[model samples]
Target: MNSPQLAIVLGTRPEIVKLAPIIRECRDRDVPHIVVHTGQHYSPQLTEVFFDELELPPPDHALGVGSATHGEQTGSMIAGIEEVLLEADPETVLVQGDTNTTLAATIAASKLDAELGHVEAGLRSDDRGMPEEVNRIICDHTADRLFAPTPAAAENLRAEGVPSDRISVTGNTVVDALQRHRGLAADRTAVLDDLGVEPGEYGLLTLHRAENVDDPDRFADLLTGVGRVAREYEMDVVYPAHPRARKKLEDLRVPNAVEVVEPLDYLEFLRLESDASVILTDSGGVQEEACVLGVPCVTLRENTERPETIAAGANRLGGVTPTGIFETAREMVGTDAEWENPFGDGDAAARILDAAAATDADGADDSAAATEAVQ
Candidate 1:
């Protein structure tokens, strides 16, 4: 007869951004919910700023599981999360995307009797080389409910032998977060003025992928290509430099054409995103957000799990090579603005929560029945 409690787990910036909507929804509904931060991204600038900007509650638990090798980090998270699961004993555990936190929490909660829900489930590049692909596949198998962001994702899950009953084609929750924050961003319009750039007159750049930023040649080529694009279009580029990319740019002596700026908080980033002419990045969440905001995106990766954005004409995959980057930028700049957003409208978070609550209630009823039968 009691309302079931929900536990939402997030670790990285993208997970925090995408999960904000569902957290807000839980607050509005007065659902008994606990938020656990894994501290996977330990920087104050990255984690604290996002929580403050999003007005998210301070996490109920911070695992303080800072950076490590992939295996070590995930193993540590599983240990930490198991402790949290035992202490919280929530009716459901919610995780977002294909991070170590998502996979570890999925495994932890699945091992327990609690219901597990995976947001952004069923995305696949079909290339097992990427650790994220492995994380996603493992989480999908472990989850009790799959909250897929698109029909394509749902179909993928079905093909992979996930029962249709456990899979629900809810739209992507990133759109909900984007729409909610874009309104706040409009009200606080000083970011553009502070950057001294007119709206829609600048290109946004973000590159932090290991492939692009870790290799010296690739890093140099990316910087050169980005600088070339800026010069060719006569557009100012505002790069909220990722810490790793910042070091690489300095080491490689990147051109002065690209302005390296400190990372913006979520609202500031959203405002900048709203006003940018185009976004060039390897970030998965940015790909979805750009599509939702109707901004043309040139993905810096060779491939993406969110292929619906490309199929819908909202984005194009541009590899890290100089020629590939330049060609894609030119193509996007020349493309028409009539592209459709394959990602859903701003209702995804609501839909996901609805399904979760229903699933939780049904689970509780079944458990009660089993107990009575035992008696």
Candidate 2:
């Protein structure tokens, strides 16, 4: 088989969802590309199932580098991704978001004869204590092309002294995936009924960040705060527990008003986000989705990379304390969901691919130069 022109590297569920549109673009344009799953999220539910749901081709390579310490996990992913890069020898490698996989793939691709493009680049939470903050910083600095999702993100790249030529404000791909699939989710899934909640009457909750869920006290506090708000409003707060957070839930005291359920599939989750009155999450992707879906959002983090949501009045930062959560929920729950979608017009995939194809063309020219020099 001929070497692919592009290698799309992903590991977690969000990566699959965000990258699905780009992969589809490659297929539609008949661009030669291979997908490599680093298996940072090894669960079939989290990784493999998204391919089927998103109607994406199976990953050409699955590394199966499951959970471990940060060092151990990233180390395994770097080694595994290096092997894939060596074999495929793609002209460009694309990675998304700030996962261990993204950092690992960036490191591996930087060492090889490949141009690296980082989607959703130049986002800075400015909280280096967060593992994701560190991962994203490294990926942005090392990547050859930075696909900033907003002008603000592009400015961030500029502030970092990344040449403006290297950064493109391609918007966030989550908008593309949401716009494409939301109608399908509404029509195909009965997730609201299955969860025993009424549309526009329930609060959807998702907490998975290690800073939020790893500590039993913080985890319990977040749940308690969210649950109290749900009770105050006489609304049910549905928490779809991530695999990482489930273990913490087992040891904690869950509130009565918060119903903790197993993680839902992409369609189910999308449907939930659309129909819910408000969304409470620590996931950056969820913040973007809730904003686009016109559902008010209260981010559990003290700070967010997607400050666009806050500036647009579509979201609020609700810290981990119960009072803070309650106050923010009280402030946002009754507001009109009329905030304009700050992300884009649902065509980020095309812009990113356009930039990527240009990068691939430049790589060919550079390769040709090397060959001539050797001759």
**Candidate 2 residues 38-111, lDDT tens each?**
88888888878899999997899988889999999999999999999999999999999999999999999999
Relative to the true structure, how large is the alpha-carbon lDDT of every model? 0.84, 0.88
Candidate 1 total steric clashes: 0
Tens digits of per-residue lDDT for model 1, 1-375: 343489999999999988999999999999999999999888887898898888988998999998898889989999999998887889999999998899889889988979999999989988788888999999998898888887788779889998777777777878778877888998975889998888778999888877778889988888788888888889988899877678777778776768889877888889888888889988888988888787889998889999988988989988888889888999887466587767676777877787787733353343233223212
RMSD of each: 6.0, 6.0
Candidate 1: where is the Cα deviation over 4 Å?
A: 1-4, 360-375
TM-score, one value per model: 0.92, 0.95
Candidate 2 backbone overlaps, count: 0
RMSD of 2: 6.0
> What TM-score does prediction 1 earn?
0.92
Tell me how candidate 1 scores on lDDT. Answer: 0.84
